[model samples]
Target chain A: MGIHIGVDLGGTNVRAAVVLENGTVERLLQEKTEPEQGAEFTIQKIIHMVENLAEGRTIEGIGIGAPGPLDPHRGVILNPPNLPGWDEVAIVDQIKAHFSVDVQLTNDANVAALAEARYGNGRGFSSVFYITVSTGVGGGLVLDGKVFNGAQGYAGEIGNMILNPNGYHYSNLNKGSLESYASGTAIGKRAYELYGIKGGSEEVFDRLKNGDEQAQRVVDDAIEYLAMGIANLTHILNPEVFVIGGGVMNAGDLVWVPLKERIKKYLYPELVPMMNLKPSALSGDAGVIGASLLTRK
Target chain B: MGIHIGVDLGGTNVRAAVVLENGTVERLLQEKTEPEQGAEFTIQKIIHMVENLAEGRTIEGIGIGAPGPLDPHRGVILNPPNLPGWDEVAIVDQIKAHFSVDVQLTNDANVAALAEARYGNGRGFSSVFYITVSTGVGGGLVLDGKVFNGAQGYAGEIGNMILNPNGYHYSNLNKGSLESYASGTAIGKRAYELYGIKGGSEEVFDRLKNGDEQAQRVVDDAIEYLAMGIANLTHILNPEVFVIGGGVMNAGDLVWVPLKERIKKYLYPELVPMMNLKPSALSGDAGVIGASLLTRK
Candidate 1:
């Protein structure tokens, strides 16, 4: 059994953890990313954190989950939107040179999906499509226990998939993108527009539970679009399970029940019975743990 | 180098071929499937064809491309819509029992994609999404030189992907499915509705070329929807290239030029430069050659 190091590199913070072969966390460390100090400083901080964590341990390899537009094969982190001033940094090579260990890099969402597929609700499934309905819709596809990174490592960019090209237009994506309809940000925005009350997705869900007609309408609409996106995914991927995560999924049954019912309306009759939709079990630790699993044989 | 036997089993006919390791067709045979003759009769016909092809020759294995909804893993031909009585027939077991060679089965579209990826225009690409725009739109995803059969071997059913939930209804798929908008069957039906004339897709293309306004509108609408579907596929899969085949693609520049331009309008700017679209190079031979390639070591 080999021990591995996993790093979740986010815009606000960098988290590192030492994980055992059985998917157990041995030690954890967190620190501010401080991207304002530039790429060199950030890289140094990550190296120091990993060194401290591995001081008395035998580690096989390291995996880092970062925001994309990255060249995973070349180990180069391209200009990610949130990580300012970190343009074209060869983070894997730098870390490998410093630690004398193998390093692998993938997008954060993909790592989270890998985590779910390997250790969470999708543990026994051979294929899993993990979707995060947070501020923005993000997806990760795990096929045969491995991340299915298509050409250029941009396979699971499902947020940009157009749900209705004639619907509302988003600046970054085409009209009626899944992100514009199903994401928490989209729900919040739509809720505010309809009721003239600005609130997050949580507040909207609360209002729906209290039987607010307007809120119910807004949430129901989002659920419908979410189901549409999931149905489209089902037709394309036919994964064993769809493991959903993110802040909005915290609404629990309010989200899953309607979502499942709506998905059934669009799926192939033969496929409706095969649909296995579940909530994420690992929460925030999924990215770190999944990243570490990248180095696993 | 090994010689292989490839069988293409369609509703109306069965085609078998002897293929060399280099993807060259050495011998070919064609016969009516006559599926109404019963499953045992069809199995015997396939066995006889394979024996004829393998006479005085050494072969590695046999590969069959059949209408889907079949179990590729167990090699069982489920009751596909076209093959009326093919109710869970173990095609692989029967073929293997008759001949002392391994046998593999996959959906027809997937095998065609494999042929394109391994021996056609997609040879050097690591990922390929092959779409055939015949009577109904069908898709096959070849990732890392293999078919990406999802959990139940239903991975590349892109025809069922929804383009508009509010648009025209199709019995076999959800309302406003990609197939409903872009398939040849859909195009011809729309042309008939618009002009009160019944004609095939090729006749519509000819009318459009001959400066018929109604025909132009019908073809343009189809092109727009097809481009939208391709764009959605691009966002989700981001394959290295999109290899298009089938009769509708024979319209050449009228289809490809407008399609390329329309897809560019929907794709992310960064991804625009990364798009590599091409036409299938192997013509109708892809299915047989691809099925044979399945037996390659």
Candidate 2:
């Protein structure tokens, strides 16, 4: 067995880890991304982190999980809003040049999907759809342990999935998009707009946890739209299971209980009993862990 | 080197065909399903059809394309409204008892998808999403020439996909479902309700063909909902190609021209350029041809 290195490059932080075959971390390191300095600076930072984590171990392969709008097939990081000023960065090529083994790249959502399907809650299922309702509602479909990135690498871009044609306008996403209704950012904005609660999603969840009727109403509305998105996905893909993660999901029972109940209303009667959904086990570590496992393929 | 028989057991008729390796029908026969007579009677008729088509040749395998709610894995035809009183009939077991080879079964939408992906317009695409806009809107996902029947064999049940929470209801499907808005049956019903156009979808198309403004508006509303469904599918699966077929598509340019133009507005900028959608090449023959091809696996 050879050493596998995983790099998760986010806007604020870049994490690197030397992961074991069974998803165990031998060593891990983190550094400020400072992406505004440019793609080259971030690439150097990633390389330094990897070198330190490896400590001269003969590396088998390296995998990276980055923000979307990037090309997984080409291994290029396009100008995603998260990675500002980093236009057309050939991340894989740069990393591959430094490493002796192969380099692979995929979006953050896909990385989590792979992690969940292989090493976490979605482990036993043949098909696993991983949905992260964080700042935005992104999803990844993992089939037989590989990410189904679709024709243009846009397969799991479910954030822009239109739920209501005239619902809400969030950034450049479609009006009434799922992200606009269910995402953490959306929840925070919704809380402020509806009840003038400036505290955001955390505050809303806290209020709901404390048994506030107003918070329940707001959450019910969000859950309703979220259920529609999941149901649309279910009717379309019928994957074995759905593993939901991200900051929004951390609301715990406030979201999970209502979500589980809401989703049932949309599924076929026969499917109701077999609707397999679970929370992500890997949590924040999924990005790096899934990246490391990508080398196995 | 072997002979394959395909049986398309519909509510109205049962068509059996001896299909070549290249999806060509060597010989075909048809008879009234007489499902009302009972599943047992229909089974005898199917066996008779297959026996006649085989003509004492060494039979290889048999495949069936039927309406859904059937268990594809167990080869059981559940109580679908189309096949009245055929509840949990072990069609495969019964057919296998009469034949010396394996018997395959799947929903009609899946069979069409398999046919389109392997022998028709979707040929050459790695993943094909085939949508049949007939009396009802149903779809199938074919990945790498194989049908992805999903967990409970409900994959590609796009007809039930919820487009609007408060939209139209067709049978027991989700309110505001794609089928309720875009299917031929839906079009006819909507046309009749809005303009008292008793001539059904044909009249709507004919009127729209002659530049009827009212027909144009009705078609536009339906197209808008249909566009949402397609856009949702595009973002969710991002398959290589989409092959659309069925009675509604036969309306030709009336639906196709508007559908193509409308769908663009809902897709991502990158996907807009690479949207590989086409008319189903096999058309009405997809069910029979796809059923036959199923035996190959």
Candidate 3:
């Protein structure tokens, strides 16, 4: 049986892995995208990492999961915020030129949702919403076991949905979006605003863990907003379960416990009993796993 | 050829009709859903209307679209706010027993999305988010020509996604859901609070059409919030188009023109050019048409 290749192309790194049919990582390779060197160079870097991972083995197909606002149907990265100087690059054709294989591409969040649907927290559900709480919040939606690609192939971009209306500004996706409050940057900003200090997100989280008063306030505020965002998802999509992944989840119980409580507090009373709030089962490897399954069909 | 029977069960009335494959309605029948009669009796009323609409024709399947929180998988209606006493009614079973046809049930909003996808504004799009800015905002999501029933069969309920953080004292869905700021109820409440009067939601839209200062402020505030909400959707789903419906949209260009402009202002700089925002194509018959299509399969 031929193995599939999953490539996760991020601004700082290009991670490639050979995935078996059962969703296991068989072989892995990593390198830098070096996007500052221009689109062609980044494309070449992606090819190099994939080639290195393949090592002359027979390959089924390839899937690349990248940052958002890109055209998933066309496999073009349209000026993602994290990867600068790469705008409207025909990534699919460029990759095809380097390797003779079928290829699929999607925003990273959508890929993550796919991973959850097939192998992680969302496996048993027909509709799933996956959220990654890392440097910034990102999300993807899976409806009936297939990625719910919107008219523009951007259906599950949940982070930008506004969460707060009284903030510095308004984002159409969500006001006071999950990003505005749950993302690391937002947490840091809130920490600084609350404590008048720099490099405090980690410190405040640590303090909250250790029972520090001021830190608890900042962390509590973030959790409140995060829970509110989750509750928004609960009210809007009513997904079976919300899979929360990404680096911030390292805060563990600090995040999940309060987030679940607040979401329950705010969800429609009828829906509150049916809602499921859970952490992402696949964490670090979600991107690779989701990307690998990208070529399943 | 066998046709499908659809029943649009609403708080005020029940409309039943037989729909042909090409999206035509025949033998349409309408009657009030008298709540004083209780839940079991209401189900009987619906069954009677559907049988009357079916007349002598052989119907293959039956579909019912009701005020939601319906367990699409279980075919139960879980006490939606609009229709009281509809607590976990096994609507699909009741209809099936009465007509001896396959029966399906979903929220009115979800079926509306299906209707838009199959026979209305949502045609030609792989995914569509159908939202009604009416008495209480409700929504539906259709992906790849199918309604997206979440894990628990509740998805595309965007109306309750909170917009305000501190302005409204609401329940679990969102303290300041879109309904709090932009729904017909919210519009009237805000107008009443601002202008100190009372009347139909249409009256406020009429006053705005006539350029009443206070009414415009109230309406404008609502519109701005709505635009902000759309922006949030753009950020999250990046949908190709938003097919808006409901009583509020009857304001026509007076509402959509400015609303679209404001939404663009909030989109990511690169994505603003790719978005398409439009008024809903189906009107009074949306619920019925959507309900009809729900039984198509």
Candidate 4:
């Protein structure tokens, strides 16, 4: 079987892994992205990492997952919001110029979805909708073992879905977007507003576990909106399984038990049995693992 | 270059058409369904219509679009709410036994989507999401010229999507479902409640054209909610084009102009140009025409 290299590129860090055809990570390494130094510096760092990982082993292809709004077809990283000085960089061309092998690029969420569907909890599922509820809520759909990219490669932008037209107004998005209520950023903001405490989503979950009434209210609202968003996707896609990942899911039963109950209330009686929600099995490595599978295309 | 037959079965009427491979209707006929006569009688009537449509001409396959909750895989019409006598009726097997030809069965909305994707405004588009906003709001997705039937064949049940949790509650569906606010039946009920006038959606439009303020309010509300529903789908699926049909669309500019303007408010700035909403071209014959295309699978 051929060997492959997978790269998970983010604003804060860069990671690369050598993976086998059977979706196993053979060797992995991580380093700071240091985006302040610019795209050329970052690109060289990535190439160096891949070269070291490849060593004497023959690598057939390389796949990279980047924060998106990038053109996957053209292989250019457009102006992604998180990574500074990485606008319209020909990452694919630059990497391919040195590697002498295929290089594929896709959105981070999309690669994670592919990884989960192929190697994690969704391995047996033909259709999977993967949702990440961290800093911002994002999602990707894997249908029939392939990423279902809609027109313009902008499908699965589920976080932008409206949950309440009259709710909070985010400057970047419309009022009451799903992300405004369910994302980790939203939870932290709500907790700060209600109790005048500046803390992360983990802090809010801790307060809830300690039976803080205000914290409980904040978490309950997030669960309700998240469940509503999931139910809406169920109506449209009816995927075999919904694989949820992200830092917020670390709340575990505090989110899952109530979320499943809320989802049932919104779904059709007949569709209740079809609504299968599972926690993502790959955790932090999903990005690199999924990036590797991009070469399969 | 082969001929196929398409059947559109409804509670009140049955329509069949001979369709060419290029998606043209060669010959068409319609008659009362009289479903009260029972499932066996309806099946026999359908067989008779197909025989007449064939008329000694060689046909490669047949496709039937039925009111759903039906099993497309097993080809069974399972206890649809509208068809009282259709309880697990093996329509496909019975028809195939008589004609010895390939027969495909799918939900009415899905078949309509298929027809529109093949022959209507979606002809040049790669992905199309078709929506019908008449007595009820229903939708179907056609991706790469094929109907995307998700897990258990219940995909595209967009009517069941909730727009407002505290709004109207239907006995069969969750509160504030899109159908509760946008369907023709909902429009009529709202019209009666507001003005004490029991009238159809056409009457409401007529009143709006004549400058009745109450009628205008009802329609404007419907248009707003419909746009919200479309915008929700836009954020999730991001299809190339959205083709809308059904009796409500007959209001034309009253719905189209506001729907387009309102949808823009909810979409991402970059995605605004990609949102293409078109009126359905096949009109009343979409069901039958789309059914015929199902055999293309």
C-alpha RMSD values across all candidates: 2.2, 1.2, 2.3, 2.0
DockQ measured for candidate 1: 0.74
B1-297: candidate 2 lDDT, tens digit per residue: 679988999999999999999889999999999899999999999999999999999889999999998889999998898998888999999999988688999999999999999989999999999999888999999999899998889999999888777788889899988999998888889989988999888888888889999888888888888888889888888899999998888878888888988889888877788988899998567778999888796
lDDT tens digits, residue span B1-297, model 1 = 446999999999999999888899999999999999998998899888988888857778999999878878889888888798779989999999877788999999899999999988889998899988888788889888888788777888888888887888865788989889888888888888878758777779889788888888888888898898888888777889999998888889988999999999888776788889899999677778989977777
| Regions of candidate 4 where Cα sits further than 4 Å from its true position | A56-58, B1-3, B57-59
Off by over 4 Å in 2: none
Which 10 successive residues of model 2 chain B have the least lDDT summed? B280-289
What is the lDDT of every predicted structure here?
A: 0.87, 0.89, 0.78, 0.87
Q: What TM-score would chain A of each candidate receive against the reference chain A? A: 0.96, 0.98, 0.94, 0.97
Instruction: Report DockQ per prediction, comma-separated.
Output: 0.74, 0.79, 0.62, 0.71
Candidate 3 regions exceeding 4 Å error are A168-175, B170-173
Q: Candidate 4, clashing residue pairs? A: none
Measured on C-alpha atoms, candidate 4 has an lDDT of 0.87
Top-scoring candidate (lDDT): 2
Q: How many backbone clashes does candidate 1 have?
A: 0
State the DockQ, from 0 to 1, for candidate 2.
0.79
lDDT digits (tens) for residues A219-251 of candidate 3: 788788778777777766677778888877889
lDDT tens digits, residues A169-236, model 2? 89878778899898888888988888898888888888988998878888888888999999989888
**What lDDT is reached at residue B75 by model 2?**
94
